[model samples]
Target: MWGGCWPAGPLRRSAFTRRLSVPISAPEALLTVRGLEAGYGKIGVLHGVDLHIAAGEVVTLLGPNGAGKTSLLRALSGLLPWSGGSARFGGLELRGVGPREAAQAGLVHVIEGHRVFTQISVTDNLLLAGYDLPRAERMARVEEALSFFPEIAAKRHEKGGALSGGQQQMLAVAQGLVRRPRLLMLDEPSAGLSPVLVDRVLNVVRELQARGTAVLLVEQLIEKALGAADRVYALAQGRIVLEAATSEADLPRRLERAYFGDDAVSPLEA
Candidate 1:
């Protein structure tokens, strides 16, 4: 689906590159993470995760429940603090960063579950996303974001509660687009929706890519996720177990092995 092509730039050495011990220059990646670790209060969830996302590229993170997919996104977006390791976004370090700072720095996270303020107007919901901006700029950004979802844009004046579940999800994504983030991280965007609605939502990823906005997608629909991303990373037991281009042969089989620890030999090992 990725057409076996990478974005035009000097590619950086990623977790997969390190696995092969390939020599490369320092990373110029839009987002880079090395040996990242995080957890809730006393329960650790992530361990030494390494990843990188290039500008204008779509990367999907796939894993089963409890594989730390959500936790990893939270850590990168500053919703959860990292206990160890390092991350940099657009040349800014992520240590001690909060959610607001992350968004301001163009690293926006659209959390799962289609969370929204049901009592407010759809425009108000988007306005709140850009509240920190000047009034005119904020309004203009809201209009720009709404353009991505005409379904909700038509209901701009209606209360958020009036929208269906799928529309709410679209609004949630529009909220992230308000910031015009350099990198947008989505967590399980297709959790609950009809097949058509699911396709509608995933189609937005292609639109974003066309606009040169990078995306980190965490999805349950394996086929859809792979279809939208240029690269895939499989996380199992809080660590990245597989990283490969979507165009590679036998990827589904390799992913299966990575997830279940099957004893079959992998191309990565061949």
Candidate 2:
């Protein structure tokens, strides 16, 4: 079923593809990073990475495995501390900010994998996301988030372990939505999901964009990622190699060259 959703053929354009003709300028960007670097003890992963995401824009980050995509997201969301450089979200400095502070500042990271607690009820899991809120506001936020995923809303009382893999993924995303973040960083939401379920998850990016929420997505599905984004950034060896508007022509060829270096042959020429 997963194979059918993402086949080795020409790319399938997503129904939610953006039609923007011009890229967002840096001055209006919602998130900005300059010369950012981070890694686990004694090892460096990201090297002088510079990137920006405009308000309400969907920007997809693509690269082969070990491209530091996950590391970049972790650094931005305060999961991994930045060792050098600087980052600013909504004009506030990000250094020394922790995960909870990042979320409270309207920058939420929905980490890869279906990470919900199996023993907890679906609604309870969402409630935990808003645990710091007042009683009434927390309940209201939970209801607002459930509105986006009727599949899980119908199973609100069920333990997270009882849901299928797809539903669990939805619940994880819903957990992020409970905060109503201004900028959501999704680290491969499509991982391990069937194509149908992948589409269901990507569709939420569209809904979020329509409501003026910006997203920085790191995904493995090239076609789907490009389809859902207004711009694309390719990271290789812990650095950004390519940045282009999704509407540009010959993107596959450009992406190939970016991934394999300038010497790579375009599919058309080959």
Global Cα RMSD, each model: 7.2, 6.3
Worst-scoring 10-residue span by lDDT in model 2? 12-21
Q: Write the per-residue lDDT of candidate 1 for residues 15-57, one digit (tens) a residue.
A: 2223322212234689988999999988889989989998999
- Residue 147's lDDT within candidate 2 is 90
TM-score per candidate: 0.88, 0.89
lDDT of 1: 0.83
TM-score for candidate 2 = 0.89
Q: What is the lDDT of residue 49 in candidate 2?
A: 85
**Residue pairs in clash, model 1:** none
